[model samples]
Target: MAKKKFPLAHVYRLLEPGPVVLVTTAHAGRTNIMAMSWHMMIDFEPPIVGCVVSDRSHTFGILRKTKECVINIPTVDMVKKVVGIGSTSGRSVDKFKRFALTPGAASYVKAPLIEECYANLECTLIDTRGAARYNLFILKVHKAWVRPLGKIVRTIHHCGRGRFRVDGSMITVPSTIK
Candidate 1:
């Protein structure tokens, strides 16, 4: 096999670890949403998620004040809206209305769930040690909902430079770890 060397700059998105998600947050009577790709599950038993929200981002302040949010997993069909959400600052726009998304009241959090997404995880910010320096928020997912299975839904994964790859094909294998 022939190996080619490449710049280290583009390695971050070689394959994003998880699906792109829309984070919905509410603070002081204001609700906002933003597209987030830098997130991962840090724990399985209690469903802990770690994500980055830039300190300069509008959502950052809102999330900081509220200390809660909803992680909405959009389907591949909603890629356009996802990009649009990320393109504009929520500070100047009401994403739910601008993106034509419904705000469904969440049962566990003050943040509303994005109705169009296939899955929504109601999260509460549980840690802030790395927030000031890294803009990293550690969230505890207390409640989650997923669209019915067997619906042929796909998730979009960012591949850097405005390019994305849709999840395709399903495979199952026997495992005893569970």
Candidate 2:
């Protein structure tokens, strides 16, 4: 039997509607953050998250070594910084310093959370097989913190190619009487 091959763009589009995530990692004394829209929550009991990171990315190395990361959820105002982080590499420059981002200490992991973000989820890598083979890392979320003030702001959603959309008005569904 033969397997079907698909274009990268087509594969990416399938992963659309993925929330933008800031993959933060630290090893030794250096730390870095990268923007990724290819992330999703896979489990609920232990609160697991799956994120795709290129094997060649510097963050991948740090995550591999530390086995921990912080998924920072940014607001619509952070679109510029999100795009900037995605464009640059942490190996060449300190992304936090280069982008003027503040890092706050995490409660359970060595990886620091982006202070300016709307929400932060500290996680520890529990599965590495996917990362090695498909550049996908599965993390078990240890804790989550949300900013009260930032919650009012719209969430930033990526639409590929530097394009983004802010979260719109909310709609509530009423429960049917049993």
Candidate 3:
């Protein structure tokens, strides 16, 4: 087998995280949604999540000031809307209305959850030490919601360069931890 060099700029495609999530935030009565794929679980007991929200994004300022957000996991069925949300800014467009997405109130956070998503996690900002340098925001999940889907929920994962991968099958493997 032979291997070739891969571009550093496209490295993110190889390490795409779990899923592309729609992050909802509200500030001063204005709400916004930003599509995020650069998130990862940091802890299990309290459910810590580390996500990168670009400093230039509209949601970044709101998420920082309000210190809370809803991480909505959209399925493959809503791929087009997800891409649309990522392409446009809330400053000019009303995402909920433009994308025809329903906003549901969260129990803990001020941010509304996207009803079209398979799952939603209400989170509060826990740390911003890395935000200045890396745009990383550490969040603590205060509450969670999951729709009762009869079959497997196929979440979308961004592979960079406008490419995406959908959740496929599930396999049971022996584990000692659980």
Top-scoring candidate (TM-score)? 3
On the 0 to 100 scale, the lDDT of residue 148 in model 3 is: 90
* C-alpha lDDT (0 to 100) for residue 131 of candidate 2: 76
- Which candidate would rank higher by lDDT, 1 or 3? 3
The lDDT of each candidate is: 0.92, 0.86, 0.93
Model 2 lDDT tens row, 1-178: 9988878776765556656878899988999999888888798878898888998889888888899999999888788888899999999989999889999999999999999998899999899899768999899999999988632568877766776777867666897942
Q: Tens digits of per-residue lDDT for model 3 on 61-152?
A: 98889999999999999999999999999999899999999999999988999998989999999999999999999999999999998667
- TM-score of each predicted structure versus truth: 0.95, 0.88, 0.97
- Candidate 2: segments with Cα more than 4 A from true spot: 1-11, 150-152, 175-178
Model 1 lDDT tens row, 29-57 = 88899999999889996999999999879
- Looking at model 1, how many pairs of residues clash? 0
What's the true lDDT of residue 36 in model 2? 87
What global local distance difference test value does model 1 have? 0.92
Candidate 2 vs. true structure, TM-score:
0.88
Cα distance off (Å), candidate 3, residue 22: 0.1
Backbone clash pairs for candidate 2 read none
In model 3, what lDDT does residue 1 have?
80
